[model samples]
Target: MQSAQQASVPQSDADRLRARAVWLYYAEGCTQSEIAGQLGINRVMVVRLLADARRRNEVRITIAAPLGDLAGMERALETRYGIGRVILAPFADPAGDPTKVIAAAAGNFISSGMKSGMTVGVGWGRTLYNALPFITGATLQDFRVVSLLGGIAAARRFNPAEFAWQFAELFQGEGFLIPAPAVVDSPETKHALLERCGLAAIFEMAGQLDMALVSCGGISQITTSYRTGHITESDRRSLVETGAVGDVLYNFIDAQGRPVEHEVNARAISVQLDQLRRTPERVLISGGREKHVALRAAILTLSPTVLISDEQSAKALLAEG
Candidate 1:
């Protein structure tokens, strides 16, 4: 009886250690080393205690903002578009940079949603690139990131491959990048590469993604797609002629959220819009007066689970008929 009582004492102490570790790490937001110092234990022991706490389901984190601030707009957007969650970021200057504000909010949303094992698909644009700096670093096991589009030949800050790689590094996860150019010479070439050049593996992975982070681009001279020379003047003219308002992943869409019929649609090398819609958690992060039509089209097309946008864009989206 004495031996059994002594053994139970260690187990009881372990429970206390795990509880303290969880409180410090999750509730107090302390780093592992800080927790170790506070508890008079080694960092490795602190790490184990936290892991054990997680295994015992002693830690659950939730992110809740005061909805009263943006509740009106959020409710309007949610009611109109059937969006699952709408996070409207406030800006001191309504005319200020929408990308910066939205990106910051998106970074928080993504960080909170992520878990130990998740396969995330990322799209590229200036707005998406802005989110990179704001993502918090973490070490997640079995985490993976896949670039949903092919790379742009020209070196640019917001390249698809670069964004995907950086996002993966933020979580210390594996990254799978599409090796082909953003646009191939022809539809046949796109099909050939996807069928024979091992690029199909990336697409297959995209199909099984747990979450997708994507942004839209308005078809304007200032838009990243046009400014980067990915879409030429003639391409723009032809796309407009076909009723394209904006593009998601280089796939042009009209006001009605249907893909515009154009040759560029066939030559584009990216995940299909329909597949994006099927992702378990689709997050659309984009805003700006220029993107009003484009953003509206995306909401109708993707039915994003979460939308991170500015107040102005939210009003503009609601104003649209």
Candidate 2:
């Protein structure tokens, strides 16, 4: 009689059974009818409950699918991140040369979007610098290209101006140069440089960019452009201490999407983060597991509309998250 009173209180036997059924089906590989029979329930009820398990979001299916199928992963990532577009380069060997693929993909992306009457902002980095040569001659009538960050004068690779010129030539538009070094000797120098007429004009142009092209750099002191003399050691240490993960256009941001504090950043000759955010379409092109942590940090900070990267980096990033 006491047991009968206890049993009178309703319990979700159906939900409990459904969860068990899913475990059996997925983990134990038991057939639906087998589970139903074992649980003393109707086969149809078992099927309904199994589906209900998914419908009510009780079970989350995780498929570690390869990024070789560009269409599905691209869509998944775009929807998940609320990004406008996602481009994945060819993964020839499933583990091929990342650098070459990044350059090729960037080249293809630039070729497709390099049109007339558009103001394109570009940031300096090796990958983006490499892609410059791949951009063949095209007539960019009335288009413009602006440097998103200041030019690299101290530790030269390829000139940011040259990269800007390539895009300008492709679109037959004007090339606006941000003539200040990416990092200055001091914050005072940065302020002075920003007030200069020629550089200020270019920075203004960058603020009005329609689209931007940039690459994410690594956090490693040894790997960073700053450590390589592209930017000073003091600047690198300061940025790191301020929680900067990596940079796109010399605008550093922390893990929680907060901009790092730096006196030089305010009066710097480079295009500002707020300016980049205001730009209608900021596109970032980058890849690598080494940069995965920094990439996520950048995404949180900038919220770029589109990203062009290879499979390895994408997988690494997704895994990281």
Q: Write down the worst ten-residue block by lDDT for model 2.
A: 1-10
Please identify model 1 stretches exceeding 4 Å from their true place: 1-68, 92-94, 225-227
What tens digits encode model 1's per-residue C-alpha lDDT throughout 1-321?
A: 113422444777868877888788767878767898998877656645654454444554433544338789999999999999999887545566778778878877886888888999999888888775456557789999999999987857678887887677667688899999888889999999999999998899999999999998888554554245557888888899899999889889999899999999999889999989889999999998889899999998999999999888998888887
lDDT per residue as tens, model 2, 1-321: 113422443557655766788898768878767898888766655545554554355654332434367777777768766779988775645455576577767776776777778888887666786664344445556788887766665444445665665555545567777766676777777767766546677777777788988777766565644335555668778778877877666666776667778754554456777778888997888877667667777776678898888777777666654
Number of the predicted model whose TM-score against the real structure is largest: 1
How much lDDT does candidate 1 score? 0.82
Write down the TM-score of every candidate. Answer: 0.78, 0.71
Tell me how far candidate 2 lies from the true structure as C-alpha RMSD in angstroms.
24.2
Clashes of each: 0, 3
